[model samples]
Target: MTTTQKYAATGAWNEPEGATPRGTVALLPGRGETAASYARLGRRLAADGYRVRYVPVTLDDIADARAAVEELLADESLPAPRVLLGSDSGAALAGQFVAELPVDGAVLAAIALPGSAHGEVGADWADEVDARTACPVHRAVLATDEEFARGAIASPLPWETIAIGAQDRPTLALHGTDDRVTPLAPALEVYARAARTDVRLVQGGRHDVLNDVAHRSVAATIVLFLESLRLSPEAPPIVTGLG
Candidate 1:
């Protein structure tokens, strides 16, 4: 659970003691989210041999956020095959990064689409938690997180500018069938523009797919994607049907 900070409250997790590092992921937290929001995700990916650097992005100053991300990606200590992973508004930023940066790949989860009904804040704390995630632990995380903007889930994002766009890099798009903030239909439309995208939907998942109840499976899917990338940037599947 080692960490380093510079531009913002960033968090970094390294690979396990004796394992060869698989790759590096520059993670961008969703709107109103802090680096702590991804503690579980960071630890999980790191344990599986991938280095995870949670880089918090601020909408208040897009320039600063992008600069922070660029600085992290330029860090030679992180290893190659760098990937951009983002959820919610952060997912939108990942889309922008993969298109503009030199990253090898991207993972977009619960992407906040343009014109989607994410503007109205939830009625109360309990309702907000329900809309955000179904995982009890994650619920507690949000509840106690004084820094977490409680109703940001319902806040409108600049989807027209930030929504994912066509990109040449290997991309993985994840969404929840039960996502209330941004429905699946429009998100599908968004990913359809990128022919190289690998899309997966979590059953009964809420807006925060990365921290939802099926987080383990979601993380495994990401690992498989990473392994595929290790083999080739095309991300061919390593395992196939039993002979």
Candidate 2:
């Protein structure tokens, strides 16, 4: 399936020719990231028949972001089993939406939590890039993307406003074990609140698990989770018998 891009600022990647869309993923980007930051992810998911929309989110205009998300979910052109996906602070925002919206499921990646020990704030751009991801391509993307927020990684998240309650719908939680931004322990604590949540760890990965070195594997895992969600929100494992 070929990937095609649409919309100017708010990017939309649609399913290939003649292929029916499997589902829709409305993604809220983390701090300082513009729609361009998720081009790779959008293409990958779109190739797999999932319509991916990069919904811009920022600490500055949250009410507008929530309104945009609601409008995207309301659009009938996007297929069913709609999933709210996000990373870092974006993940926190997605959690808030999952609590209030009628989304079919959620995918939370590299969730930044309040009171978490993120390394030195105001570090140089090099340090911030290294802390976020080790992939040269992603690092270059951050370096060159004029729209990307340089020191936004260290910016504080509004924990009070982003509280995630126990979710009744299926939730896929992904984190990097070696993440320097939001540590694994506290992120796990947040996921534990939901008993049925499926958690996956990216070993030796940094903060940006989605754009990390093992991004292909991460995308595959997300595809598996999305496929499972199509069957049921419980997300029954498609491949079983592993001991």
Candidate 3:
């Protein structure tokens, strides 16, 4: 069964049913994305016997993203051992929220690293930087990605701080080896600072890894990681080889 509801305080949310309610996995979409973007993934999780909640975050609602997450968790009516799955800007927001919440784990895809959007560069330099940067650069280079244009990049908060602060929580950082949007090098640096070992770099994968063929494997890995935590929240981190 699937149910769609409006989270007056957050935005729209889609809830999918499952047997025994394995647990709720809050799906946070990227910049300029709507809850519908996660429909496929949410439905997949729901079919896999896990309750899935897709949350939409827009530019105007970015500031309330964290609060919205808190509100979702406060419901108490949901199942236990909830996890957060976020991409792009949503990944950063998830990290910040987890630091204040009691989630069982998190899966971050196409995570933006600190300084990835900082510094001023000319169109030519931006183009050059995009070619050399680890994450996807087309968006940043073209200055069309709303996340960067809407002042999201200029925010003073550091990604390192958020990652490090959530050190104790089980986290899975998924990144595309050739992601030009969110450089992989800076993301790895932040992952290292957090001493996190559950990082996966998918080869030939782009920023929209969630929609790629590798999504199945990625989702399976995430489910396994969540299950491992369910059994032992303090289990040792399982790091997969970089693709």
Candidate 4:
């Protein structure tokens, strides 16, 4: 089914089909990224029985993005369990709401791995720009957005004020081993500091694991992770074996 829909300032919506949805997923794209970048990821989520919503995000659009998330939560057609997902810098944005937010779970992908914050991109940043998407065709589609992509966004310490007890919520941090944009080490550090955190490192995967060559594997892992969250608290852990 066609999941894309129009919303304020480039559209943020949820697409649900067939039977009751497994859950609602609100996706936030990283800086230099727009909702268009999420076309592939959103489709995958919807196909897996999820009501997917792409929370439009950019440097100055965070407030709008939060509002969009709130709007989706209040949606009557959607299901109970909700997952918030963000990529790269957008992951930081999604992380900020772990405390009082109504969401059940969260996934931070290719997040600016915990590390010293720097403004300038590395020298090879340009050469590897398209490497984020394992599929050359998808990379070309993403390039349209990158050309007009926003400047580098900031990544403040996401764990600093994560509400003392918010650690109870399930959080997944995923990163590609070869992610030059956001190194894997820092993301590992973020997971290390979490309470019930599961980390997945996609071997040879680049920054855009959601749209990478191994995106199916990453998305499947995501499905299992979200499924685990919807289960009873005492359920066995999800064995992604995606190290």
Report every candidate's CA lDDT.
Answer: 0.82, 0.83, 0.61, 0.67
lDDT of 1 by residue, 80-182 (tens): 7889999988888888778778789999998886564452446787877788889999887777778888767666664344445546789999999988787
Clashing pairs in 1: 118-154
In angstroms, give how far residue 227 of model 1 lies from its true place: 1.0
The candidate scoring highest on lDDT is 2
Q: In model 2, where do residues sit more than 4 Å from their true spots?
A: 1-10, 116-122
What TM-score, over all chains together, does every model reach?
0.91, 0.92, 0.71, 0.79
Indicate the residue-level lDDT of 30 in model 1: 86
Q: How do the residues 1-243 of candidate 3 rate in per-residue lDDT, one tens digit apiece?
A: 234223322333333333466677877866545554455566566665566676665435546777777777887766767888888777877765665777877888876555534232234534433432333432332244232333333233333344534677778888878776666777777666554447888887666566554667777777777667666776454565776
| Residue pairs in candidate 4 whose N, alpha carbon or C atoms collide under 3 angstroms | 114-186
Q: Which 10 successive residues of model 4 have the least lDDT summed?
A: 157-166
Per residue, candidate 4 scores C-alpha lDDT tens digits across 131-237 of 46567756766666544353343333333322212377777878888776666765676667767767888998887778788888998988888788778433246
Alpha-carbon shift of residue 217 in model 4 (angstroms): 0.3
Q: What's the ranking of the predictions by lDDT, best on top?
A: 2, 1, 4, 3
